[model samples]
Target: MTAYDPIELKRIRWRSRRGLLELDLVLERFFAQRFDSLSPAEIDAYKRILDLPDTDFLDVVNGKADLDDPEEAAIIEILRAV
Candidate 1:
Protein backbone atom coordinates (compact mmCIF):
# COMPACT_ATOMS: atom_id res chain seq x y z
CA MET A 1 0.00 0.00 0.00
CA THR A 2 3.00 2.24 -0.11
CA ALA A 3 3.29 5.02 -2.68
CA TYR A 4 5.80 3.15 -4.76
CA ASP A 5 5.15 -0.18 -6.41
CA PRO A 6 7.29 -1.09 -9.40
CA ILE A 7 4.80 -3.34 -11.12
CA GLU A 8 1.83 -1.05 -10.67
CA LEU A 9 3.92 1.97 -11.63
CA LYS A 10 4.93 0.22 -14.80
CA ARG A 11 1.30 -0.39 -15.65
CA ILE A 12 0.48 3.20 -14.78
CA ARG A 13 3.20 4.44 -17.07
CA TRP A 14 1.78 2.41 -19.91
CA ARG A 15 -1.77 3.47 -19.23
CA SER A 16 -0.83 7.11 -18.98
CA ARG A 17 0.01 7.13 -22.65
CA ARG A 18 -2.91 8.78 -24.42
CA GLY A 19 -3.94 9.23 -28.04
CA LEU A 20 -4.20 12.94 -27.54
CA LEU A 21 -0.92 14.83 -27.76
CA GLU A 22 -1.96 17.28 -25.06
CA LEU A 23 -2.86 14.46 -22.71
CA ASP A 24 0.49 12.86 -23.39
CA LEU A 25 2.29 16.06 -22.52
CA VAL A 26 0.30 16.59 -19.36
CA LEU A 27 0.73 13.04 -18.13
CA GLU A 28 4.44 13.13 -18.96
CA ARG A 29 4.89 16.22 -16.86
CA PHE A 30 2.68 14.78 -14.13
CA PHE A 31 4.75 11.66 -13.84
CA ALA A 32 8.05 13.50 -13.98
CA GLN A 33 7.06 16.01 -11.32
CA ARG A 34 4.69 14.08 -9.05
CA PHE A 35 4.56 10.37 -9.64
CA ASP A 36 7.03 9.47 -6.92
CA SER A 37 5.06 11.40 -4.32
CA LEU A 38 1.64 9.94 -5.12
CA SER A 39 -0.27 8.25 -2.32
CA PRO A 40 -1.77 4.83 -2.99
CA ALA A 41 -5.24 6.32 -3.21
CA GLU A 42 -4.07 9.00 -5.58
CA ILE A 43 -2.47 6.36 -7.74
CA ASP A 44 -5.72 4.40 -7.74
CA ALA A 45 -7.59 7.52 -8.76
CA TYR A 46 -5.14 8.05 -11.59
CA LYS A 47 -5.65 4.48 -12.75
CA ARG A 48 -9.36 5.13 -13.04
CA ILE A 49 -8.69 8.40 -14.78
CA LEU A 50 -6.60 6.52 -17.31
CA ASP A 51 -9.61 4.36 -18.09
CA LEU A 52 -11.35 7.37 -19.60
CA PRO A 53 -11.29 7.89 -23.39
CA ASP A 54 -8.81 10.46 -24.67
CA THR A 55 -11.33 13.26 -25.22
CA ASP A 56 -13.13 12.66 -21.95
CA PHE A 57 -9.82 12.47 -20.17
CA LEU A 58 -8.70 15.74 -21.67
CA ASP A 59 -11.99 17.39 -20.82
CA VAL A 60 -11.70 16.31 -17.21
CA VAL A 61 -8.13 17.49 -16.99
CA ASN A 62 -9.14 20.79 -18.51
CA GLY A 63 -11.96 21.25 -15.98
CA LYS A 64 -14.74 20.89 -18.51
CA ALA A 65 -16.30 17.80 -16.92
CA ASP A 66 -17.61 16.97 -13.49
CA LEU A 67 -16.39 14.07 -11.41
CA ASP A 68 -18.37 12.92 -8.37
CA ASP A 69 -15.38 11.08 -6.97
CA PRO A 70 -13.32 13.54 -4.98
CA GLU A 71 -10.26 11.36 -5.28
CA GLU A 72 -10.38 11.49 -9.08
CA ALA A 73 -11.15 15.19 -8.91
CA ALA A 74 -8.08 15.72 -6.78
CA ILE A 75 -5.95 13.84 -9.28
CA ILE A 76 -7.34 15.97 -12.11
CA GLU A 77 -6.33 19.04 -10.14
CA ILE A 78 -2.81 17.73 -9.96
CA LEU A 79 -2.83 17.02 -13.69
CA ARG A 80 -4.04 20.54 -14.35
CA ALA A 81 -1.17 21.94 -12.34
CA VAL A 82 1.30 20.01 -14.47
Candidate 2:
Protein backbone atom coordinates (compact mmCIF):
# COMPACT_ATOMS: atom_id res chain seq x y z
CA MET A 1 0.00 0.00 0.00
CA THR A 2 1.18 3.52 -0.70
CA ALA A 3 0.98 5.83 2.25
CA TYR A 4 -0.20 9.36 1.54
CA ASP A 5 0.36 12.40 3.69
CA PRO A 6 -2.84 13.61 5.34
CA ILE A 7 -2.74 16.86 3.41
CA GLU A 8 -2.45 15.10 0.06
CA LEU A 9 -5.23 12.77 1.05
CA LYS A 10 -7.38 15.72 1.99
CA ARG A 11 -6.77 17.27 -1.40
CA ILE A 12 -7.65 14.03 -3.09
CA ARG A 13 -10.85 13.79 -1.08
CA TRP A 14 -11.70 17.32 -2.07
CA ARG A 15 -11.15 16.60 -5.74
CA SER A 16 -13.31 13.55 -5.45
CA ARG A 17 -16.24 15.76 -4.63
CA ARG A 18 -17.85 16.15 -8.04
CA GLY A 19 -20.59 18.49 -9.22
CA LEU A 20 -22.90 15.61 -9.92
CA LEU A 21 -24.41 13.87 -6.91
CA GLU A 22 -24.03 10.39 -8.42
CA LEU A 23 -20.41 11.03 -9.29
CA ASP A 24 -19.76 12.40 -5.82
CA LEU A 25 -21.30 9.37 -4.15
CA VAL A 26 -19.41 6.91 -6.34
CA LEU A 27 -16.07 8.67 -5.96
CA GLU A 28 -16.45 9.27 -2.23
CA ARG A 29 -17.27 5.63 -1.69
CA PHE A 30 -14.25 4.58 -3.73
CA PHE A 31 -12.03 7.01 -1.86
CA ALA A 32 -13.22 5.76 1.49
CA GLN A 33 -13.11 2.09 0.56
CA ARG A 34 -10.04 1.89 -1.71
CA PHE A 35 -7.76 4.89 -1.51
CA ASP A 36 -5.74 3.56 1.40
CA SER A 37 -4.89 0.37 -0.45
CA LEU A 38 -3.97 1.94 -3.81
CA SER A 39 -0.53 1.47 -5.27
CA PRO A 40 1.46 4.59 -6.15
CA ALA A 41 0.63 4.24 -9.83
CA GLU A 42 -3.02 3.79 -9.04
CA ILE A 43 -2.98 6.86 -6.85
CA ASP A 44 -1.46 8.85 -9.67
CA ALA A 45 -4.08 7.54 -12.04
CA TYR A 46 -6.79 8.56 -9.62
CA LYS A 47 -5.38 12.06 -9.44
CA ARG A 48 -5.30 12.33 -13.21
CA ILE A 49 -8.85 11.08 -13.41
CA LEU A 50 -9.99 13.75 -10.97
CA ASP A 51 -8.95 16.29 -13.57
CA LEU A 52 -11.30 14.89 -16.17
CA PRO A 53 -14.36 16.95 -17.11
CA ASP A 54 -17.36 16.12 -14.95
CA THR A 55 -19.29 14.63 -17.87
CA ASP A 56 -16.41 12.42 -18.89
CA PHE A 57 -15.87 11.39 -15.33
CA LEU A 58 -19.52 10.47 -14.94
CA ASP A 59 -19.52 8.51 -18.19
CA VAL A 60 -16.46 6.59 -17.10
CA VAL A 61 -17.99 5.76 -13.75
CA ASN A 62 -21.26 4.73 -15.38
CA GLY A 63 -19.51 2.57 -18.02
CA LYS A 64 -20.87 4.77 -20.76
CA ALA A 65 -17.49 6.00 -21.95
CA ASP A 66 -14.10 4.46 -22.48
CA LEU A 67 -10.76 6.02 -21.66
CA ASP A 68 -8.12 5.43 -24.33
CA ASP A 69 -5.44 5.85 -21.69
CA PRO A 70 -4.88 2.50 -20.08
CA GLU A 71 -3.99 3.88 -16.67
CA GLU A 72 -7.11 6.00 -16.57
CA ALA A 73 -9.21 3.10 -17.72
CA ALA A 74 -7.75 0.90 -15.02
CA ILE A 75 -8.51 3.46 -12.34
CA ILE A 76 -12.05 3.87 -13.63
CA GLU A 77 -12.51 0.12 -13.56
CA ILE A 78 -11.40 0.02 -9.95
CA LEU A 79 -13.73 2.85 -9.05
CA ARG A 80 -16.66 1.18 -10.77
CA ALA A 81 -15.88 -2.13 -9.13
CA VAL A 82 -15.98 -0.54 -5.72
Top candidate on TM-score is 1
Please write out the lDDT profile of model 2 over residues 1-82, one tens digit for every residue.
5666668878888888879999988887886787788887788888998899999889888999888889889988988898
TM-scores, one per candidate? 0.92, 0.88
> What are the RMSDs of all candidates, in order?
1.6, 1.3
- What are the Cα lDDT values of the candidates? 0.88, 0.84
Extract clashing residue pairs from model 1. Answer: none
TM-score of 1: 0.92
Q: Candidate 1 on 9-79: residue-level lDDT in tens? A: 89889988889999999999998899888898888888988898899989988889968899999988898
